[model samples]
Target chain A: MARTLINLPKTAKAGAVIEIKTLISHPMETGYRPGPEGRLVPRDIITEFVCRFEGEEVFRAELFPATSANPYLTFTTLAERSGTFTFTWTGDNGFSQTESAALTVT
Target chain B: MRRALLGLLLLAVPAAAEIAPGERRSGFDQMTPELRAMQTDEAANPGQLWVGDGEEAWAAAPPTGRPACAGCHGAVATMRGVAARYPAWDEAAARPVDLQGRINLCRTRHQGADPLPFESRPLLALTAAVAAQSRGLPVAPPADPRLDPARAEGERLFTRRTGQLDLACAQCHDALWGRRLGASTIPQGHPNGYPLYRLEWQDLGSLQRRLRNCLTGMRAEPYPFGAPEYLALELHLMRRAQGLAIEAPAVRP
Candidate 1:
């Protein structure tokens, strides 16, 4: 899995709408079958992913098998008095990631 | 005034090559007969092994809780042209739906089959078998007023850019298609051949899957499977390559 890339507005009004972008590099295999040797590849997938502002969850998602590998999401959020925004990914592999960026509200 | 008008026209003119600018393609000139042959071989053989496995799964698993698709369709060859005609204008749904969506509907409503994941091999093989039926025929979507919205949506989605790279579909396929993107070349990335076998992927992939791949390549937040915007793009791409040959299970270098 490749590291995710996130792009958020460097600066925004204290209370303005901004689009947040996130992309992760994951093969996202929906382990429904075996790839080689007929052994089940095992069902491992990213089941939950979320974004938070200062420890407060802002956006959350429950992924299914239909979701593509390397999931990408675009969303809007109110820039409520900038602070540290954290993004996290939780997958079936028990693999999780947490990355954060500073947002300055002016 | 005429001279100035001509100048403006010249300024407006595009000097791009066959593909959109900033994109890379080996170009028709560089396409080797050998490479084309390899791809042709894959297409010719088709993924019979996988489809055969799917047929067995369909028979044993009983997704529909009815009988196997083999029992109803007998042989998939009889169901040819079904895929090419869908996201068909379903009278019941009143919309265009792709094979996966249709399969889901059938599994839930008709057969009680399980809805496989988007990239699942079973789903891929089943859809491939169905689409394979239309292997030789040109994709001809029905003409209806309802398709207007989808067409426009597709066009818009095709051109809109939303990513750190900030490049739209046109930027690559239309603007800098023939240009270099690092080491590899970019093809026009036409949708004529999908559920294609890409050397990079080493397996069959759908049109929707390709669109998601492009979004990732562009570093944009990609939409979900069966997303309206992406579906529109697929519809538009299929429409764009209307007369092109359907090259499924094709191998790309």
Candidate 2:
């Protein structure tokens, strides 16, 4: 399983906008770097990230080779009700991981 | 008579120039506000990835089925303040062993596993994880008589000039710290933070790696990883950094 860190308030007021931050461990190796034999290191990068609240999509991003190693992302989402936030990252070589955190709207 | 007195005063200058213990500053203090923020925020610090990996490794059993580190050491939290006393003297080796050395020793002797290569992800992850447990504790090198000789040798290495640049660690870190070195300010070169995430490398790394980088930058042949000289130097550094808080997994530019 990919190591990930997610930051969000455990509770938020209804209609309030809350910030969410995430970081995941991945080399995100761009194909440009050379190896010991001076051959290009093959490209490996996370291509997509999506977050859903109560099973409805809230935020999404399409990543590229330019993204750094251990990709970190921060965004804001509206809190409408108490639910779980599920985060998914899909990448090259069939690498995909899904993790979730719960939030309460009161 | 005046000339003789002036010569004596000149002889005293270098000794007096060493930074006083009360004045010592951590690399953390020298960082840009953004980098400091990055180090403080767990969610944003890239080093946390390694710590997370380490937490897993602590409990994982190798294919050989030997006990995991946690089996003997208990919870990782129990390791609090342990890193502060590293580069401690080892009776079995009759030499000093830094935190990484101790970890590798455990794998080989206790777990019956091959030692992980230096700079490898597994090694960095585990070292960072272990050091993170001591994050807020003051570095307290054990008062072991056996460590005295190694610490002395380390002090010599720190002050001795070599390499194409003909510089000693003290020339910059001790005498000229807080001064500008090209585009960056020279830091005091304390080891309070090890296994930190340097933005320039875009990866987590150990203190030995950082020291080697400095050696190479001076146009000197860096000793191979796990060299005794490096361990001696680490012992001295921890002693020199006494009372400084550990900041392993710190972020740096």
Candidate 3:
């Protein structure tokens, strides 16, 4: 399983825009690069990333081959209530990982 | 008579000025603001991914069915400050072994597993994790008589010119540090931040890999990985960086 890191404030004021950051380890190999014996390396990349709060989608991104290895994303979302934020990353080679964090709204 | 005296004074000057202890700077201080931010933020630092893997490996049993690291050593947190004094003398091997070597020794002697290949993900991951425990601690090379000869050899290697460039490491790192080389600023080549993530490589690498990169850049044949020369150089570097805080799993551009 690929390792991932998620960062967000444990508590935030209601209606505040809380920032969230994430990073995951993946080679994100581009198809154009040549491997041993001059053959092209096959493309493999995280196809999509989704962040949801309390089962409601908050943000989503569509990744491409050009994306760098170990994809990192940072975005802000309004904190309305206390709940868990779930993150899902789906990629080539049937790679998928899910993680969650709790945020309390004051 | 005045001209002769001036010539004598000029000849007396050393070839290169050694960097004073207080004047030394870690590669972290030389990084750009953006890169510095990347290094400080755990969520943004890609090196943490390896640390995570390392945490798992530290506890998981290998195919040998032997006890895991935690089974003997307990939680990895107890390993704090251990990495700072690496490349230490190994009584069994009758030589100096760096932190990576020590880990591999444990694998072979205690865990009954084959040594992990150099620069492999598993090795880098475990090394990074162990070194991360020493973060913020000062680099304090052990005060052992046996290490002196190796450290001297390392110093000699650092000063001796080599490769097609015929330039010693001191030329750029000690004397010309703070000067621009191409688009990059030449920072004092310190070893505090190691097993770090470099933007150029897009992956974490060991100090040996980096040293080999420099050797290749100089058009010289690099010693094989885990070579004695590389280990000696690492020993000298750790001593040179004494009192500097450890920044393992650091980020660089």
TM-score of each: 0.59, 0.93, 0.93
Instruction: State candidate 2's DockQ.
Output: 0.91
Lowest summed lDDT across 10 adjacent residues in model 3 chain B is found at B11-20
Q: What DockQ, on C-alphas, does every prediction get?
A: 0.01, 0.91, 0.90
Q: Tens digit of lDDT per residue, candidate 2, span B44-120?
A: 99999999999899989866789999999998898898899998877888888888889999999899999999999
Segments of candidate 2 deviating more than 4 angstroms: B1-15
lDDT of 3 by residue, A1-106 (tens): 7888899999999999999999988899988999998999988889999999999999999999989999999999999999999999998889899999999999
- Candidate 3 has which clashing residue pairs, if any? none
Q: What's the residue-level lDDT of B226 in candidate 1?
A: 73
Residue-level lDDT of model 3, residues B7-49, one tens digit each, is: 8878656522767789889988988899999998888989999
True contacts kept of 1: 0.00
Report residue B209 deviation for candidate 1 (angstroms).
2.0
Q: Model 3: which docking level applies?
A: high
lDDT of 2: 0.91
Judged by lDDT against the true structure, how good is candidate 1? 0.68
